[model samples]
Target: MAGDGTIEKVSIIISKGSLEGVYPGLIMANGARAEGIEANLFFTFFGLDAIHERRWERVRLATVGNPGLHLPTWVGALPGVSALMTRYMARRMDRLDIPPVPEFVEMIADTGAGLYACQASVDLFGYRREDFIGQVKDIITVGEFYDLAAGGQIIFT
Candidate 1:
């Protein structure tokens, strides 16, 4: 390891459908790229929402059970709370100039990062290959994912 202990690459699996879930993975991948490290993202299950052509722009936190919110899940589930929170978060992110999921995905793609979708998720959701963003390189099995991720730190988001 170097003095700062930087890894050469990172493989991230995004498995949540919520905005909160996808943001961390994107942020980490972007950070890794900025540091000149190889970064790859494999979107699976609900995480597929982050790469979904029709839904990526609309993903919001399913605050119903987000323990990090410090409020009763029921309170978050109440009518209108989710929308309000989503709007608030969007404005905050706007202030920071952080692009939305769609644009962020594009930005990462332009940076030479690889984006992948899970084949099992596509089968389970009844989605076709064309349903995801054009940047998706492939819909792969977990074993293939692991093979490509070998020797890299696998971070699950």
Candidate 2:
């Protein structure tokens, strides 16, 4: 679509904290960047965890409520299911050569994509700007994000 010269940029909003939740946004941002499209990743609410240094390495798949998994919500609540699912995912990604979360963030940042933390979510959760990963360009408000993303497609994941 970008070759048409109409869609030159993209803004992605990531609102979930799980491993699966975080990947789609990063993957899309990376894909856009690879396509020579400018991309901005807006991390809000639980999504902020994806860019937090201490938690990024620990982020795991959220299995409990995922209807797509076919396992009932309570089934995913079994003691080790989440961990198992996360490991399986990690292995699957390894086979596909997908970098781990932190590395993936760094890779995207290295590609010139903008990484941002949502100010309201940061304030609501009592997180200081310094708590974010170095790749984050800045912590921004939703209005600021809108201004930055003007004329671009917006994708929420």
Candidate 3:
């Protein structure tokens, strides 16, 4: 374990599986690697979408059911509202100079953070190997992920 109780290796589990949740995991993993901590990120459930090659390009904000959205959760839940909200958020992010999700993923990958897509989730979602983005190291089972996460600082972000 590390002096601060952070282990020499850190495993991050990104389960939220949305555009909003994706950045924190990527950013944190990269930051951990920058600090000389070995880092790995497992993308499961909705997060698997972030690593999907076909769908990644279409990644959008989750307006509906997202309590953190600028609009009221009810408004976001309304049909067509989510799309508009997603577009609005994208525009706002652009104005704020925030990079897109794919760009952020690229940046994280550049830092040598290990990226994995959950094999079980992928199969459940009917995603083939070719559907995932290029940065994924491999498709791993939850048990395999646990093996890596064990004895390390495991964080679910």
* Residue 121 accuracy (lDDT) in model 3: 90
TM-score, predicted candidate 2 vs. hidden true structure: 0.95
The candidate that achieves the highest lDDT relative to the unseen native structure = 2
Query: Across residues 1-157, which tens digit of lDDT does each residue of candidate 2 receive?
Result: 3567667999999999998899999999999999889999999999999999789898899889998778999989999999999999999999999999999999999999999999999999999978989999999999999999998999999
Off by over 4 Å in 1: 1-5
C-alpha local distance difference test of each model = 0.91, 0.93, 0.81
* Candidate number with the higher lDDT (2 or 3): 2
- Scanning candidate 1 in windows of ten residues, the lowest lDDT window is 1-10
* Candidate 2 local Cα displacement, residue 104, angstroms: 0.5
Q: Candidate 2 regions off by >4 Å?
A: 1-6
Ranking by lDDT: 2, 1, 3
By TM-score, who's the top model here?
A: 2
Error of 2 at 9 (Å): 0.3
lDDT of 1 by residue, 49-149 (tens): 99998999899977788888777989999998888888888999999999988999899988988999999999999999999999999999999999988
**Error of model 1, residue 130, in angstroms:** 0.5
